[model samples]
Target: MKFKDYYQALGLERGASEADIKKAYRKLAHQYHPDVSKDPQGEEKFKALAEAYATLKDPEKRAAYDNLGQRSSGEQFTPPPDWQQRYKTDAAGFDDVDLADIFAAFSQAGGRQRQDMPRPGQDYEIAAWVTLEQIFRGGEIEVGAELPEYDQNGLPHRVAHVFKITIPNGAADGQRLRLAGQGGHGVNGGRAGDLYVVLAVQPHPLYRVSGRDLYLDLPLAPWEAVLGGNIEIPTLAGPVALNIKPGTLAGQKLRLAKRGLGNRDGSTGALYAVVRIDVPNQVSPREQVLYEQLAANSTFQPRAHFATGAGA
Candidate 1:
């Protein structure tokens, strides 16, 4: 359960005035709202955007969240000290908004099984760039969401909130997660739109992802390519050992089935090891002599037929 910081999620300064918060929310909401935009993740961004605004728009609720000491450590967004103080022990002026309703927002729009159904409010969405490791195993995240604000007269307002989102194990890039009732405000008992989360996994230094499979560039020594042995390689799951077959060559890919990134239909991806032979920059004289001998015996021709076909 990641804590969501509405202010940070909405990309606002903590001390931003209500007017500033409202303006920002409108700009972003219009840009990301699914009904109006097509950001691939517009709906999810829109819902989160709206929910953030809803939370921060109300001074009392925002104040409660703000003072709860709900800190943000990447994915640990929480309220500030005395968070309980923000809520009234008993319903007073806000019987319209209560804790149960807030939690229900978590399921307002439902799951992948049903997104087209009319919701209480408009849904919002956004993309999150995460590390490959986080995808291999479940983890939490912090998202900066922008929300709208308004006056008693029903005018728009501005403010930002940060929220922590949970990432499930074996999640794929572009995969979505729904947070109900996190979308637009309900009207006449209708539920608000659900908040959807789409993941954008960043490329790892040692891993290249293709579908559910991961590829690694494993540098091999000249001897290792000829003699073959186990070598260290990195994968989305973690570092692992890959066996090098004797006489291995460049462009050769070996598969570690089901060792990739996400599940195929329901499990996990596969891992492929791409072999690359390394040439020593500072070779020993003895090694250089050996290479010279090897080169003498090498009958390999790289571009043997270009001379015959001179069309260009």
Candidate 2:
């Protein structure tokens, strides 16, 4: 038989502690697990890692394997005569038998104990699109997701599930809401994993969001911008009156406090009414006459800066 160095297979020293062994196994297992790894040799490497872990993780099996003494890997060797006596096994023709098979026999005789251990299910994250109104009102929204489910034989397959998830008041875009015991099914009575719902706020036609603040284009007539007046505007909650200041420039933002998205801390974000000055495309004859008179009498030089060096 050839000697197999279990420690070297797991990339660990012979004196590695139990915790070190478990940590190393987990890291290597994740890297080489055939389902997720792209390496061509991942399956074989994973099997080797599993075999090594199965032996080293057990106190009695590790002691028995260590008694074989240190030797170069793959070197032709034979176990000492006392090895069979210690393990209370009588076997003929040890040659050509794999090292994994040797330890597997011990596990099998122990009633396949590891298979009965509880294993937690996998966690999942899915996205759910929400509306600004939903965030403001804080209510339940239906979400559908395709998640992996394990069958009776422990084979994983995709399954669609619908969940009624609550939209938190003031929930921001890309915020994650956790639902416990809603992920993949656990094995052997283990706790099921959690499901994370990532909120993707749907784009609104009239409003833009930043953090919890709301912004809307507030179109104002030329007279309203120049003379200042109160106008009605829409908010997520309802319509509210907003005051416009005289000489308000285009693109100026008018803030309305406590009129935006609700916050988790019982506060609310500001609503910004962006000013947009508008003018009538056509004018009545009487209106044109008034405009012509104002143009003739007015001394307001709107383009005065164009002639001045200040424009340069």
Tens digit per residue, CA lDDT, model 2, 1-312: 678899998999999999999999999999999778999689689988988999999997898789888988898776567544544433333444456555644543344568767767667777788877888888899999876654333324456789998787668998998999998676668899899998988899999998889999988987788889888999988899878888888999999999888888999999999988888899999999988998899887867888875862
lDDT of every predicted structure (CA atoms): 0.67, 0.80
User: Candidate 1 lDDT, tens digit per residue, 1-312?
Assistant: 245667776889888899988998999988998777979778777777777788788775676556545566235332222322333222222222322234333232223244445545556676778888887776788877654432343222234667788876568888887877766665445676777777888878888888777888778887899899987776655677878889898879888887876663577777888888898889899988988998999896655667677542
Off by over 4 Å in 1: 1-120, 149-151, 187-190, 264-266, 281-284, 297-312
- In angstroms, how far off is 32's CA in candidate 1? 13
The C-alpha RMSD of each candidate to the native structure, in angstroms, is: 11.6, 14.1
Error of 1 at 115 (Å): 28
- Give lDDT for model 2: 0.80
The total of clashing pairs for model 2 equals: 0
Question: What's the TM-score of each model vs. the native?
Answer: 0.54, 0.58
Q: What is the lDDT of residue 22 in candidate 1?
A: 97
